[model samples]
Target chain A: MSYTTDPARIERNWRAITIELDSPRPGRLERMLQRLGLPTDVSRLVVATPALRRSWFVALGLSMLIGLLATDAAKPRDDLFVLLLIAPLVPTLGVAMAYGSNADPAHEVGLATPMSGLRLVLTRAAAVLGFSAAFLALISLLAPSAPAMAFGWLIPSFGLCSATVAAMTFMAPRRAATVAGTLWVLGVLIARGAGDDPLAAFTVVGQVLMAVVAVVGLVVAVQRRDRFDLLAVR
Target chain B: MTNSEIDAVGQADQEDRALVARIARRDRSALEQLYRRHAHWMTPRLESRCGDPDLVDMAIQDTFVSVWKSAKKYRGDGAVGAWLWGIAIRRLIDQMRKKRPTSVDLQAVGGLEHAMAFEDTLIDNGTHGSLGVALRQLDPDLRAVLIATAIDGLTTKEAARLLGVPQGTVKTRLMRARQHLQETLA
Candidate 1:
């Protein structure tokens, strides 16, 4: 037990300690993304989406409060009305906060790679949409019309989210999302008021219109996707 | 420092500084040299604070890993051993934190209480010389506070944070520690 053992006698059993040499084990979401065939770096970037950010929790908590309160206090049909209205806003909020120099913390580093901008936006938007859809579907089950009603918001949510990403190529995410989200709410309200049915926006005719919006918005997003590669695409 | 720089001990410190610099560039061999040099001494020091060999083992692993990652942060002016010990102690504290969801009480035998036990080990190893014997006669609480300030070179605020006591409490205990040590040594 001599403290001053010669260097020749010192046991360098460091092979036992190289476990930390590898990068930190990927988180659950990041691992899942990797399994889905995303590269390690891209998967990591995707998992850092708003769902894990502190502000994302604020957005989610607001949506949860709306879903739970609307279920308890509002009438059954009116509950669906409130649920439909709030569901689309979650992904819209997430997509708004997903990319752009203003929304992203890595904007300076991101500017170094000119081509990754749209790929970053699309991958991050997909993660946001998946998370928002999963969360909203669970909340919708609490509605009086449990199963069939659960799928209703998916199309509208997809439409609004895509439209926000489209708008984001030209403006900042927050402003783009605000404009997209506001338009969806106003469009739904106008439809509800114009018809005999309070849930006019949830009808099949309205669903087809949303499908059109999804197609057109994604087309515009792809065509002008290059705009996202520029500086301050706000 | 210039006058002391000629000493044999200072030359060893200078060698350790070069090893740390090499480690910053991800040199595996330099890290091994550092581990061989310090791990033999640091293990018993850590085990004296945390008896669990597994916790000590993990803490040692974490310490060298940190030294590898944070080598660039080394100021070069301080002894590399001191820098490694700082990371080791904090890492031990962190490992202890994982085993207990509640805050770690430093005074507990498995936690900072073991830190107090090191004073005994210091005497057993005769590393602290005559000061260790004199300090043994002082109250454990005063001795613990004194060790945090004197040996660890922590400021009042930092000692309070490390010991999980209020700043005012650390201040009071430090004053009492000085008074008690003077009475004991006198």
Candidate 2:
């Protein structure tokens, strides 16, 4: 038989009978409730405590505790010490790395309204770091003795994280960024320990160095402009 | 019927009806029961879309999880199976996004192949013994459009997006697909 592209035929075929699943088949309710940590009976409350939120809380609490301990240990030079110690709390970079890796190729292209990958990364990083810094600033204010001036580190720290994530994203193998970021932080901590003066713990030079590192990151990110595959490599 | 036999049938129906009600209420267990009953069929179906058994299973699992989460929103509009298929389609798309084709050509061919494969399987399972042979004989484009829009219940727009075609092309292809199917079945 000959085939034709008639509109009526298309409509007829397009609307097919919906299939029945014979669903909620048998014992599925118990299994799913068990999986979701919900109650089996419909009468009971099913509060879905997302596991991701729980993990985020754990990460936040741990970082705060680390911040408080670092402040207490270096009381007079609290600002410098806390910035150095909690430098790795620059989680926005990690988030950017994860976000870049997870983005689909179609999205990597096609969404052209003038936003570059670097711009997207920097914007998101700024938002996350800004909120984090604000939270830290509040904590410092409440404690009274804690140095709130360390909040200045937020700007460079954000830039550094964005740059590092952007550069690492361009390099082949996405996980390499995670590895490089981890090693870089570890190396910085080690270098600080090797230095002699106790007050040297809060040196402005170290913060400036990180600030420079962050700026360099942005420059590297800008250089990779049209390399969507590298920038969005999974 | 014997007393024991009557009780067994009544119990099974009671369980089925209860599950359907729970599904209507967005009960996760009811969804799980649905999964257990249909997963065997869904596994092969998704494997055709994704080309990996493991990926298909993961997609299917995620599909059920989504179904469970969205159960409270169930409006009892159509049969529960249609709703489940809708969820499954979304899950498959999500998985495809995770590890997608590296090139436009690969993506297009992959899309065409997935649709054609699904149609072949459905026809084989359609209870009409010769339907699979007829489906296999159709052109890949025709096969893909028919399976995606008709058997799968995706809108013409959705079918076009998945097939990497314009909506108008999808409509035309679908008409061609129906004429072929009707002629073959008749």
Candidate 3:
């Protein structure tokens, strides 16, 4: 074979010709990442969540403050108990908003992604839970509440959020949230009216029940996780 | 290959490996750099085989996306370019599987003219002879295996994986392709 017809030369020429075309436009990669709502910063590897917006957190924080002020104005004597019962509702709502179909605009794309829907839910839920916990802890410290009341809302918050997520598997997220919130409020009111301790829901027995509820909710949520993906397409 | 050619290929391999490492660390810039460096050539090469520019573009996008997600899994055993090709080819196959036969434009498919023109230039310059003609005369399957092994420099196992065929089949096809090309050239 002649030098020009050598297979190596031919391969080299072919590779050169193929690459002779223009490069893709500048920022195309950036644009694609943005379209996928991926973070440009390499270190920020967590998936983006629409529900964890600044406004949502602000609203949650504001609601907690309003709940505190209301309890202080209505019954200044036992404010800490009222605050614990109510404060967790805010973050419970956050968890509800973070994972459900109603809140995530990118739900369809997220479902199609290799990252399982359950994983996305769990990651975002954990973040929301952590943020809410910190926010409530700060509020408890600021309030004139006893030290024991500082973490009183923690158990009920987990229970409500878990139940909401579990209910979401079988029904729409908004409805699930509404039902869970209503039941929590009614339970608190009933306990108060029955001459029981206003903070009975946060009692040891109550905590154990809520803990059971949380565990059951989580199991149901896992078993029905695929429903989240299917619901997104719908 | 000439010493200079060997050096150039070696340099590219090193750069690609570095880029893969950065990508594994979730560096978006590295992903973009890898895309800009390869997409130009990859587009045309993939387009030549599939004939659909849209499908080629999809394959390119998916190739990078896969790289972004799985760069950590890269063992650095082979050329990064080959790994990219492996991903691109598999993505193209996936696109082909999803596309209905009637939807594909026959005219856009598998035009080796660009390659032929390059070979013609080489032949005219006395660098090669009728090797291009012999290559064009082979069956498309045989031609693909030959180009993958001989030109792309993939191992028989790699080529088989890329082509979705058994390694024994790739070896047999390669041997047959070589015998045919030698007879035709002679």
Best prediction by TM-score: 1
Tens digit of per-residue lDDT, candidate 2, span A1-234: 111223442232222111123344335433664566543432111111111133554577577656665565535455455554454444544344333435323444534636565554444455445445665565555443445454544544554565556555456324544554565566556766787643342357766766776777667667765563343423
Between candidates 1 and 3, the DockQ winner? 1
Ranked by DockQ, the better of candidates 2 and 3 is: 3
In the range A44-128, model 1's lDDT, one tens digit per residue, is 8888775457567666867675666656443667777877887888888888887766667777688688556778788888888
lDDT by residue (tens digit), candidate 3, B1-186: 689999999999899899999989988778777876777567656654555556666677778777877999999988888889888877876776667223454445434345334433443555444776777678878988887787656789867765668899999999999999889988
Instruction: Supply the global lDDT for candidate 2.
Output: 0.55
Candidate with more favorable, higher TM-score: 1 or 3: 1
Candidate 2, B115: how far from true, in Å? 13
Runs in model 3 deviating more than 4 A are A1-47, A73-77, A232-234, B1-186
Off by over 4 Å in 1: A1-22, A35-37, A70-74, B1-186
* Native A-B contact fraction in model 2: 0.00
Reported per model, the fraction of native interface contacts reproduced equals 0.30, 0.00, 0.00
Arranged by lDDT with the best first, the candidates are 1, 3, 2
TM-score of 3: 0.45
Model 1 lDDT per residue over B13-106, tens place: 8899999989999998899899988987787666655555567677888888888888999987678999888888777767765663234455
TM-score per candidate: 0.51, 0.38, 0.45
Clashes of 2: 13
Local distance difference test, per candidate? 0.76, 0.55, 0.71
